[model samples]
Target: MKHKKYQITCPYCDSPALFRPASMVHGSSVLEKGRYLYICSRWPACDSYVAAHKKGKRPMGTLANKELRHKRMLAHRALEELQQSMHMEKWAVYLWLQGHLHLNEEQAHIGLFSEQMCEQVISLCRQLIRTSTGTTA
Candidate 1:
């Protein structure tokens, strides 16, 4: 899968910064979650690194329908398979995979099986919740 690249402006320098995939760090706890490491294209000149955040939507609010549930279940199953094949934890894999899916912060958080997987799980779960609720995530 191809990972998406993000273009961010440095808060301090305001230079055009390109973010590239770096590595993953194990989270602090089961709930704390892990993060993605992004390296600045500018490298030593810029020395910028950014981490992605995990965001999730509540299951009760907008996702209380049926269609969303189906979609979420499918995504969950796919993620589970990927995790099993990779032999890694679910949350981390979800987070890494969410980027390829173009999921927003909230959606990404729901798909997670753990804190590290929060973002991916949230994204996937929101879709599931939405499908079940007959809405969109």
Candidate 2:
């Protein structure tokens, strides 16, 4: 895979981000999405990590702690439901976000959003759903 290089640093703790095998980070590679993770050196204490490409050479996004990761997941769900309900293509949903959230293409992805951005996105999605369906969301 042609992957972009990243100079990743821990977002929570200012520790060095190290490329480690999924086995080292998750204790098992089974069911993992990628072959490795960019884990914070603080590891258990900081609890920050990001998935890497299949070759384990490039970071997927900025490092996220547990809470941020959970928020991102919620953001993803909100975005998905909006697209499915609206019968819009995946890119169409993103285009809506680009307009409402004032986000550029690179910043429009949920995976790269901060916790605050995730909350904003979820709220916007709910409002959009409510308005479109004329139901409480």
Top candidate by lDDT: 2
Predicted candidate 2 versus true structure: per-residue lDDT over 90-137, tens digit per residue? 999999999998989988888788999999999999998889899656
Q: Model 2 segments beyond 4 Å from truth?
A: 1-5, 135-137
Instruction: Write one digit per residue (lDDT tens) for candidate 1, span 1-137.
Output: 44444555544356654433333223354543433344344554655444444322112112111334344556566667556655669767756756756666566644232333434554654554446557537
True lDDT of residue 4, candidate 1: 45
Off by over 4 Å in 1: 1-61, 102-106, 110-137
**Residue 91, model 2: Cα distance from true site in angstroms:** 0.7
Task: Tell me each candidate's TM-score.
Answer: 0.32, 0.86
Q: How well does candidate 2 score on lDDT at residue 5? A: 62
The positional error of residue 64 in candidate 2, measured at the CA in angstroms, is 0.8
Residue 106 C-alpha lDDT in model 2: 86
State, as a TM-score between 0 and 1, how close model 1 is to the true structure.
0.32
Residue pairs in candidate 2 whose N, alpha carbon or C atoms collide under 3 angstroms: none
